[model samples]
Target: MRVNQAALDVIPEARPPGRARPLAALRHRNYRLYWTGQCISVIGTWMQSVAQAWLVLELTDSAFLLGLVGAAQFAPILLFSLIGGVIADRVPKQRLIILTQSLMMVLALILGILVVTKTVRYEHVVVLAFLMGSLNAVDMPARQSFIIELVGKDDLMNGIALHASLFNAARVVGPALAGLLIARFGLAVCFLINAASYVPVVVQLLRIRLREPRPATGGAVWRDIAGGLRYIR
Candidate 1:
């Protein structure tokens, strides 16, 4: 049987709604690359988290110190996350993410080297944990906002849900793997692995073809901040 070319072209475009389909956002080539790279990097981030917590326990043998370390690593989120969203609105999110990810890589390497050299102290861990947390405070907003540029408004919700799924999945696998690595090797290896994981994400960010959206204007920084505050209120 012969088919009409025009009919064939029309049929593929008329996809049925409410049908179970592969997440449409993943269809974008750039987004697929970005998502894969992020997944790998997030898993490494979780692994490093587990390793760091374990290292604190090993060094101080105190649960209080471990709690302190975790708090130090997360406190900035409470303090700076709103400011971070403002920065993300003002900057190129992709470039900002690349910068923050690179910083994280360097911090991971520093911790890894200190541990491997047997020169790492509890204070060093605390300082590095705070540094990492500060970087994350900035990174999270930029990374979250970058997704809109990749897939646009049409797929934003699907992308976010998929991204959350990947994050939680990593949360599970990363800590389990870290536990194994810490038992067989050492905490330093986990940090080193985390550093290596960032490499692919950086490379992927560089390769992604995105037209960085222009920053909003017509308002002072304080005005914009106040506007956001009022909106939330």
Candidate 2:
């Protein structure tokens, strides 16, 4: 039978509403690459977190110091996540994520070398924790928002849910893996593994293709920050 090819070409490429498939977000190529990379990287991140705590306790033997390390690691997020959100809005999310991930990889490598070389001190752990936290302040917002670009709004919910699932799963798996590695090899291995994990994420992020970011609206930085705060409120 003869067909109207021109009419066929005009049909929109979208899933019908109420007919979303299982694992809907994984259908997109960009999201698949992102998810794969994240699966490895987040597990490594958790491993480093576990190793860091263990190493801190081993070095200082002070619960207060450990608590302080935890605070230093999270305080930046409390203070700068808002700023990170603003930056994420202004910059290309993909490139920003790559930069942040690369920085984190370097931090992990530094800590690993210090531990391996027997030169690590409690002071080094505290400072690295703070630096990692600061980087996270920038990375989290960009990484979270990047999912929408990977899967588009249609699968946004699915993409976010999948990411949450990945994080929780890693939390369970990574700590257990870290414990085993520490017992078998030493703490340095966990940090080194974490550093290696970032390589995949950076590579995957580089492979992702997205359109150029729109020009940021002109305004004072403080004014933008205030506007973001108000919007959140």
Candidate 3:
């Protein structure tokens, strides 16, 4: 069915000439729920990042190990990001996100419990960092695809920019909060709080009523990757 062009015309552009209006996407109910939940979740994710880095430093007392920890956390993206894009295209993005988010929660909870019990070691941190990074490899694409589904084509650019803004805003707040909690209470608190933050996003994912259309199936992975590359080239 064709969407109404008149209605499209009526929808305001997210950015006006001089004055800035942040949170314009929050005007839509689904996007609003998604925005708020993601805001909280991103902050928690950043908090965990800061806590994890500090925890690694505490254990190893080496900048190299800290860098290693960071690399392990993102290594999966370098290895599997293209595959993740394929999976995101083939699967229901929302369902993929829910699964990944749940896995992240579990990882955070495990780390939190380990720290609280004084049983966490550098090895455990390395393993968990890799696991979380693997999950993120898939989760990031699912999330990017899901935003397009939430706002549709016309507002997609606005949606992506808004999402980036939310991420940067959280980046500023999450680490500071994590540092405070780490200094006062301990790393366990940061991990536990990060685990708790996933709940709202999971709930919001479950609540979204729209059904995203599935991508066409029956392509080999390498062929699909090549096709994407060729298209871009």
Best by lDDT: 2
RMSD of each: 5.6, 4.5, 4.0
List where candidate 3 sits over 4 angstroms from the true fold.
Answer: 1-24
Better of 1 and 3 by lDDT: 3
Name every residue pair that clashes in candidate 1. Answer: none
Error of 3 at 184 (Å): 1.5
- Measured on C-alpha atoms, candidate 2 has an lDDT of 0.89
Q: Which 10 consecutive residues of model 3 have the lowest summed lDDT?
A: 4-13
Best by TM-score: 2
- Number of clashing pairs per prediction, in order: 0, 0, 0
lDDT of 2 by residue, 1-233 (tens): 98654233222257667786769888777788899999999999999999999999999999999999999999999999988988888888888999999999999999999999999999999899999999999999999998888877777898899999999999999999999999999999999999999999999878766555678777777888899888989
Write candidate 1's Cα lDDT for 109-166 as tens digits: 9999999999999999999999999888989988888777777766777778889999
TM-score comparison, 1 vs 2, better candidate: 2
Q: lDDT (CA) for every model shown?
A: 0.84, 0.89, 0.85
